[model samples]
Target: MMLMAAVLQAAVVQPAPGMLVERRLAEAIPLAVGDTVRVRALAGSAQPRPFVVAGVFEREADPNRIARNDYEVRLHLPDLEALLPTHDRVDRFAIVLAPGARADPAARWIESVAFGTRAYGSAALAEETSATFRVVSRFHDAIGIVTILASAIFLLCVMVIRVDERKRDMGTLRLIGVSRGTVFRAVVLEAIGIAVVGSVAGAGLGVVVTRIVNAHYARVYDTTLRFALVTPRIVLIAALLGLALGTIAGVLAAWRLVRVAPQKLGER
Candidate 1:
């Protein structure tokens, strides 16, 4: 929970660079340290002077966890004061409280003293955002469960059909002295192969699709909304699910084969 701030001191005082910019802003403008950047003033405002790029900072953790405006820029007090129509007016101020201090009482006191002041609690905002994420996560989980179940059912059906088609071949092998255990193992191995290949391909395709979507959103909205994150844990889960599905399908197919006698199968 490191807090970052940009401070402006006397012009004579030398600081690390001049102004600090967020990583995302730097990327958008492609600015480097020592580069001079000029910002155009909004309507009815005087023109802004150029400021040197001091440093670029990035959010150490996920941006969603922090309450910040990525597009906001911080400048030295002197620099900002020079740009403002008024010499010493500020839009807002940030106050950091000591650890374990209650913010409500302080906020109330501040509001009472200041006219038209609004106090917002960061904790409340964080809690609300977390709740929203939880709901969305549950929806995604429900969709994933439905998808997996549907895939399992489809795989089971396909394997059953494939086994039926191979009944004559299986009967010929059994007639030639192939053991039931060997036939079962062969069918199970084939199912496992198909599942493994399908799982790898599917996972790869998902990663590519997610990357593309994220890229599009970044370009359009200037935000990083990675709906799908490909990690080791995710890969492991996908692999395990695939193996489980394959095992279940293989067992069902083998069980059906065992129910029919080899002689009967050959007759059909």
Candidate 2:
């Protein structure tokens, strides 16, 4: 399942021409300036209240406004207050710190005036988000481990079968006075070549698939949560891992073939 908390945190908000509507929402409902939109004042309200679309904005003014749904709309403070049941009370407030200003004193002052009010910094939000997705992160790690192990096992099986089929060729090399180490090196290099090709192809396909999936997610959720990111470091790691697996499998197969007498291998 896609993690919603991460998506909400990464969403970008920017200044808009007028009142802002999410990009996806604007596309779905085609609103223009001076147009009127109805919103439900309260649950089970018989009639929806109409508000003028002063402007339709795609960007957000505040980053803290966590909107998970695509059908989101923003309005001016006064207009929003006018629709609420209690004009005096607000759900939350955000304060921006100026340069050279301290946060502790301001937080203390705000708490003293308003009971039950809590102040948090950007770091707190990051900590909370990480905690929320800890399990998901662990699951992803487990999947990576399983994939590596499966790849190693599959390569081992294929190399073993290939060595069996080429027994006569190995015997011929041995009869021609080729050193065991040289024969083993040749087999390992061949396996590495095949593995490198396959790994590179797989990585390319993975990158394309990841981009398509991420685009679909943005279109559907209107959020910027990337499912997969293929970076240079990731590519390097994959390539190294593929080479290691191939080397291990090839060594095992070559060892088994070399242990048998050349005369016996030739007879088989």
Candidate 3:
């Protein structure tokens, strides 16, 4: 799946010499527009021939986006047909929709026939491209959840031990007029402190583990897998989970202390 994502990201197309329509002339030839050059027509001619460089045109003006242009050359369609013997097969066709165009009928028809097209809108393409990354992201979230769950269980056990060891101390405090609320607050604060420390350490460990996996797998497979793509939202979510888990563990551990007999602890 990772390999598929990489390939899809890398896939690019360029125009051939014989093709009449090309998106960008800048990409087709090394020289600027109006620069004359010799080229053999792949479709119309039997041999290499000379041709003039027509004026260049821009296809799309979005500087940040990939440019898909329509190159106007001096060759006719018949010339293209004559150059290639296998003219029976058309490799690709470009179509543009009118403003507010709808292809629902065509789409329904295609679906009824159990077929699909590669043509998609920019938004659709973006969604499809991001889907792979989303899957990988969810996998990372699963790892975080597992870490938090394990930490919660361990902290609960530790709280249980501390409660047992400090029972006498707590009893004395209670006798001296330390309210149950104060004792509860102290225990909760301590648990939160432990959770915060453990969570920070766990985050650092996660980064190291991710780096090691990415480096080892990339070296073995000769592929790039980026593991440092952390976002603020993801980090925030992880932190909240850790905090909530910690609170739950603290509550469980404090339950027994809160339920102690007032008389037995000399609170009367």
Q: Backbone clashes per model, in order?
A: 0, 2, 3
Better of 2 and 3 by lDDT: 2
lDDT of 3 by residue, 92-205 (tens): 444566778776665455357533434555567567667656887799789967866787788899988887788878888887888988888788777887877776776778
* Best by the lDDT measure: 1
Task: Give one digit per residue, the lDDT tens place, for model 2 in 1-268.
Answer: 2688767766853323235666667677787776767765573434556766675556443323333453677877876666666667866688999999999999898888878887877788667756546777799899999999999999888888988898899899999999889888888888888789879998999899999998987676566666568999999999999999989988888888888888888775
- TM-score-sorted candidate list, best first: 2, 1, 3
Better of 1 and 3 by lDDT: 1
Candidate ranking under lDDT, highest first, comes to 1, 2, 3
Which residue pairs overlap in candidate 1's backbone? none
lDDT by residue (tens digit), candidate 1, 1-268: 1222233335446643267787787887788878888764463388856778878876444547434544656777877776667776566677889999999999998789778886668777567658767888899999999999998998888889999999999998998999999999888888888789889998999899889887885666555555458887988899999999998999899889967899877665
Q: Which stretches of candidate 1 lie over 4 Å from their true place?
A: 1-70, 76-128, 223-227
- Count steric clashes of candidate 2: 2
Candidate 3 similarity to native, TM-score? 0.52
Against the unseen true structure, what C-alpha lDDT does each candidate score? 0.79, 0.77, 0.64
Pick by TM-score: 1 or 2, better one: 2
